[model samples]
Target chain A: MIQRLLLLLFLIVFAVSETADAAVKTIVLDGSTTVGPVAKSFAIYFTKKYGVRVTVSESGSGNGAKSLINSSCTIATMSRAMKEAEIAAARKKGVNPVAHVIAFDGLAMVIHPANPVRSLSISQIRSIYQGTIRNWKEVGGANARIVVIQRESNSGTQESFKELVTGKRMRITGNSETQSSNGAVKNRVSTTLSSIGFLSLGFVDSSVKVIAVNGVVPNEKTVKNGAYKVTRPLYLYTNGQPSGLVKQFIDLPNTPEGKGMITELGLVSR
Target chain B: MNIGTRKILDRSFTAVGIGSIVVMALALMIVVVPIVYNGIGAVFFTGTVEHRKMLHAEFKRGDSQNLDSEVASTDRYRAKVYDMLTGFEAELETMAPEKKTEYTAKYAQVQSALRALLGPLPGDPEPMLTRFKYGQTRWEKAEEKLHDLLYESKWDNSNSSVMSKEFFVSRAISFEGTSLARLFPYVKENLENMLHPEFTFYWGFITDSSVDSHFFGGIWPEIQGTFFLAIGAMLFAFPLGVVAAVYFTEYAKPGFLNSMLRSANSTLAGVPSIVFGMFGLAFFINTMKVSESKSVIAGALTLAIMILPTIIRAAEEAILAVPKTYREASLSLGSSKWNTIATVILPAALPGILTGGVISLGRAAGETAPIIFTAAVSVGSAIGLADVFSSPTPALSWNIYNLASEHEAAAQLRHVQYGMVLALVTIVLLLNLSAIVLRARISKKLKC
Candidate 1:
């Protein structure tokens, strides 16, 4: 009887404390590293404005979609559209996920600043990466072996590159050097004299020269106007029409604050 | 020194050692604690549900807002929803308070219909306002309806299969189930999505099985390719390693030629693995026109050379460890020098030779840099394995490296890669342990 009374008192105190504190909302955002900065910025502003918490994680687009499918995150940020198979999988689970354009990104083909070549035609760029053109000399550059750098499979950047450059066809060169992230690819290209790699325009800077593909450089105008052919939409895919914190966070990325952040991050405004 | 002084010194030294272990353990905790603590803290953190509800309210706030699109669907949705809500409100004007329930239900249906219709608008603002006007009236009516149905709607809160089950259960959950019962928590997961995920293009190099255009399915062909290369290495190294060890330990005299051979063999062991790879490429692949400069045979031969020292050392130690008395006994029986050494010394050292072969095999399987220069790409399904005399093959270590470094997004599978490492380690461990166990069994049988 004494123990039971103590438990009752404790329960009462717990209920009182629970009622005293306001609830918090947590939204998990996961997907493309390309979309990560914008998502993170939105999450930060949303959290501050509404007192709701948001978590952001960056994997590649494929993994991000998996995170949504696997129920690991509230939203999947992708630089590509959801494939038919993914939509079917979600529908199978009775989840009719909705997508909203978060922003746009121009995939950048970059090289060391020291590289002599300033521009490459789409055909030339494809040939370099596809191993058909092994040496830079063929493309009006010094006679040096072009060290081709590539991204790992899970990267959204790789998907965009394949879609835009290869038209979803052609194999990558056998001897290509692989880097894990945009920074790593940039670093490798910067340090290696004859190395070339692709990155999202969001990651472009003075360290590496963003080469013009067929005289088209990666810019907000280029990407937005579709003049930069190697561009993909950054997307926020939700399990369903977001209801609750997720919806609020999703809306936040399309707001003035979110757009400004995307612009600052070098991502093209949607 | 007295015995007690010696004992005190030993005790203090032991205490120092124990203290150092504790200090190291504490340092390890410093590294691990924050990770574990944050994981626990995030899981147990509360106050999420109310925030979730509030966010939902935000979505509905502008639900009655205008959509900018002039599309046919938006126009139809806007007009249909406005008509239903306007008709409901007009109907409500004539309704008595006793008939408020019917008016409310009709009002809710109008809002749901409006929300459903305008949801697809691409942020167009004109039709959205009309949709919103209908939604607000619908929202109030729906809230009332929700309050009435709240208890009945989520009555079966314990159904694990329902994602909304958590919404109905009391927030303060205390019971912890055994491992078997823990399966209920994951019931809502779309496991098929995990089992059949849409992979991107990076997986194409490994396995192209996704039926999708992205990946090539699996690295199974690469794995098989690596196996072929490692097997080729073993084939060339095993017999040669054993023969050299047999000659050195069993038959070679303690003279100039023997010592010269021994010194040269020992010196060969000092050559770097990469040097061997280069040599193999130069001598075998390039000069011989053995398919290409980066073929499996060249890689295998290069690895065989790299592992030669290991094989030789193991075989030599095994053959040398065989007692001279056994050779003498066989000689006393008038057996030929070759026969006596073969029949007596070789049989006794079989276990040791196998131990050496296992070590050599492990090194061949795991070496990456050597194969990188000598064989095909670090991880390629296009294996040069068909013509054993010419083709190049990739290796497992190369597979891990390529998957980790070059395969976009394969870096995200750190756990899977780590698990693969664990598997590789287990293979080596089992092989070594099996050799030890075999030696022990053989010795026991010989003793009996």
Candidate 2:
């Protein structure tokens, strides 16, 4: 009986191993919390269509670059372009950094649904971030302290905001609260009445009011036409040219099904 | 059994007991030593002049005269480094366009590294973020920045079978023939003079509010929030737990109903902490509309329910542990049964009950999951006492998870995370220690 049981266990192990070997094609993408939702949706779609597994990790863009240079991931999804130093580092490791534009995203300035302010000029936003304008009343809103919320320092969204809205030389006030993700910023703004925060356009929902930037509200058309001021392109970086599952996954943005998925996720399709 | 076999069994039993204790001690040390060491770094470290300057500028606590003198001395050494950068910029202007572009990018890296190490360079625009307004605040971080200034870190991935290895190339080598070559060595050598390092006891790490997403400043908000949540849980749970215990021990007779209630209590205790959080969300926040959203009162009630079983169990055991003679003595002295239970029985079991209460307090404070959907937030200042009814706040247990896992700059703020863990562990351990002491005192007083 013991010998028959041993034989049965061996057969089961061999079958499992054979199936695992057959299922070797997998894609790994990591980085950029801003682009995480799109990456996740593509992974789900690709997996469902092609029966290939795809894994995505939402660290910031810097870590994604690091993962690519380290050759740990097949693709690195970033909301921002790779920095020169990061590119050089990847080249040094014999990894040629290539960019694939997946979608366009606008940085939506979000406030509580109860907030009365509809539009804020670029200069007014800068002044509020710079701590010069402390109260909502100072910017045509309610009489409450403007509780500024920002993304953490290493966030790709944070970097883009620094480049576009707040000048690189300007500092966000020390008093402003910092959240980690676009989702977190949305949550904070939606719940807190006297708060203002920024999130990726994909995360914009009815729970929070999206402030018009410089008299233009960010939508798919405005962001795509470059009329929205705080817009950035999302990217998936592959080490050299992607082939097989990686190519198929990255090419999803250009396909009708892929565009539908991207649009469904509230991102501007390429 | 033979005498010899019996002796061997006894010896083996003793060995097993000693071995287990040694293993436990080793395990505790492995976990605690790193926490204590890194936690100490949060408050006590070789702080640079920039640290003093930050304190002076932000909190207005440091001696201005002393700080001014140190800044002046550091600036004297920093002047040469700035001069080298200026020289390199001029040299870049004279080079060919391609050379200028290459050098400019490389030069930008060097300048940012220097800025990170020693704050703003001369002729640089004033920085907007409070982070860039000061240089490396700690000496160890200064060394790390100095290394960055000297070398460009790159990965080597030659073999497909193995992981890539990281190696640093000297930045001086890259700027071999350029004027920028002089900048690396000069900055590397004069770093100490440029950032006067001195040991600092920054007690404010426990008291002051954080700045710039905890890249600077302290964790007082998280600590205070943990206190509020734990205490609030106790305020609701302790009385209810003891009342149920009294009912079970003194009034209720053992039967099917009693057994069913006990089984339900145990079943509630067996439920997962995340389930408790979900229940809190559904029953309190969603269904009952507890302050519209996540609030301290909602969290406290959730935690109260979560810990209620443990508290009831502990109170029952303590009440049972009280000598029956005490009750008899009270009754003989003409006191009614209720009076005996109120004054005599309760006072006798007070320490044991307190011991359980203290443990539950620590458990509530250390818990993260139950409060995640109830009261805890990733980033919020300490709320006023009145705000506990309606507002959410950052608690130590939840923020530790947030800072470690979810913070964008999680890698850069290891000290803060360790400090938080240490703070929580200390709070729980201190509560337990006080309970142990109280029990000892109670035992001694009873003996007398």
Candidate 3:
């Protein structure tokens, strides 16, 4: 009888504590490897200002949508807008995903900083990714083979590149090496003399030459004004109309302070 | 020194030894407990009805009749939750536009939380992704989802001196007097009926292919790849290592050439693993154009080089450890020097040589760096024996690093990562265990 009473007491305490755990505020932001850097910075600043514990995960845009639809995350930070299928899926689950544009990013074609080739036409770039243009000399560079570095299949940046540059129905060569993230792609391109890869404009550094496409170099001005072809808007998706902390977080990129932070990270803010 | 002083010193020394052993054991426990606990979760946990549904739909492994009955029972309770949602939606439509918008936002939160806890509602359209087709497969996640339904979490930033604290407001209080208010309590009360979680032992985790980058599935490809790479390395290194060891022990005179060769072996052993990857890439792939790109053959070759020196050293020691009387006896019985060395000396050293080979195989299997450039790929289906010369495959070592670090949903798949680690540890330990048993049996036979 005493053991039973003690067990009941222990269970009561456990139940009470478990319910109390719900009181802690946490904002979960997931999705988009390309938008990861900006989301991380925003989370840090937001947590500092609002005292909200913000968790950010960089799984890719599709996963971000999945998280939002699944109600796992409060905000899904995506480098690309939700596809029709994703929006339908969210609506089906009663999650009215509302897109908030945060920043603009350009897919910059990068090569070894020492490579002499200045620019490539859209068709030439397509051919290179398509495996038709295998050597650097074909694109007016050295005699080395162009080691194509690409992001893995889960990357939103890779999806965007395929849509804008590679086009559907054309496959990237099997020999093209696959890396997991923008940083990895940049690392490969920087280290390999004959390698060519694409990264978000913000990830471009002096170690790699951010080559021009169709006579236009990717930058804040070029990407923002639509002069650069391979540009996309970064987004943060919230289910229905965001309120409280979620609203404040979604509106961060519009604030003067947030714009400065975004620009510092090499992203173009409207 | 006095007798008591000497005794005190001796006691302290014994205490020190015991303390050190305790510390080592404690360290080992600290490292192993979490791994074993989480690793067990990969195969054994409170699996919900959705987990069963996923198994039935994806792998076709569960009983249809039992699953249907369970679904029917859960659905009987779930109907009321859906009724409350539609009623709330209707109430919102009749309200003022501003109020309607406000309620719509709040209503969506409750709906999503319900969807997460249970599967998609009756009126909801079919979901494309398998992840959405089911609710929380694990009971812990289900409870977390239920909390989201009960409370609306908000951050309290009133204090400026410290980090903000989060506070949860009861959803029932937020929607007081509304049709949705009654839904929260009713659903919470009947959550067990909604999701029948049971302890499941899913042995398929070792055999099944992963679903959605290891959100669910097994580590079969990684296990097979480790086996292939390790065996392939042994195929190349064992005979060559043993021959080199034999030559060094019996034929080579102790002179300048021998010392230089020994120094070179040590130098090769000292090279960092990542440098071996780079060298493999440069020499094997780029220079020799081995199979055009990364392959099992290339990886095995790189691993053989990495482990060759160790094998050679071990074999040399084993050959030297053989008693001189055995070789002398064989020679006195009119046996040629070469025949005596092969039949008697090698037989005596066989177990020792095998122990080295087994250890080398484990090293080759666990190694990630040398294979990264030469053979390992982050993601690929398991290849057959014929494809080893041309195809790069997912290995346990590389996949563990890839899944733990680079996977988009790495944190969500902690169970898979731990399972992979446990699988690898088991494989390596088993190899070492077999080596021990083999050596023991050989020693027993020799004595007889």
User: Number of the top candidate by lDDT?
Assistant: 2
Candidate 1 chain B superposition, TM-score: 0.55
Instruction: Give the true-contact fraction for every prediction, in order.
Output: 0.00, 0.01, 0.01
lDDT of 3 by residue, B1-448 (tens): 9999999999999999999999999999998888788888888989999899899987898999999999999889888988888898889989999988888899888888888789788777665334557898888888988998899876454543322345799999999989989998998899988889899999988877565446666777677778778878888999999999999999999999999999998898888888887787667765676664467888888898889998998899999999999989999999998898799998899889989988988899899999876776544444556566766667889878867655534555677899998888888988788778778878777788
* Weakest 10 consecutive residues of candidate 1 chain B by summed lDDT: B208-217
Is candidate 1 or 2 superior in lDDT? 2
**Structure candidate 2, residue pairs in collision:** A171-B128, A171-B129
DockQ of each: 0.02, 0.02, 0.02
Write candidate 3's Cα lDDT for A126-207 as tens digits. Answer: 9999899998888777677889998877678888899999885679988899987776777678778788999888777655
- Give residue B441's error in model 2 in angstroms: 2.0
Q: Candidate 3: lDDT of B286?
A: 56
In model 3, how large is the Cα lDDT of residue B52? 91
Models sorted by TM-score, best on top? 2, 3, 1
For residues A1-270, could you state the per-residue lDDT of candidate 2 as single tens digits?
223533664464344334432333446667787887677666655655676645455657876787677665678888888888999998988999999999999999998766667799999999999999999878777677999999887688888898899987888999899987776787677678789999888877656789899999999999999999999999999989988777888898998877866775678987
In model 2, the Cα lDDT at residue B379 comes to: 47
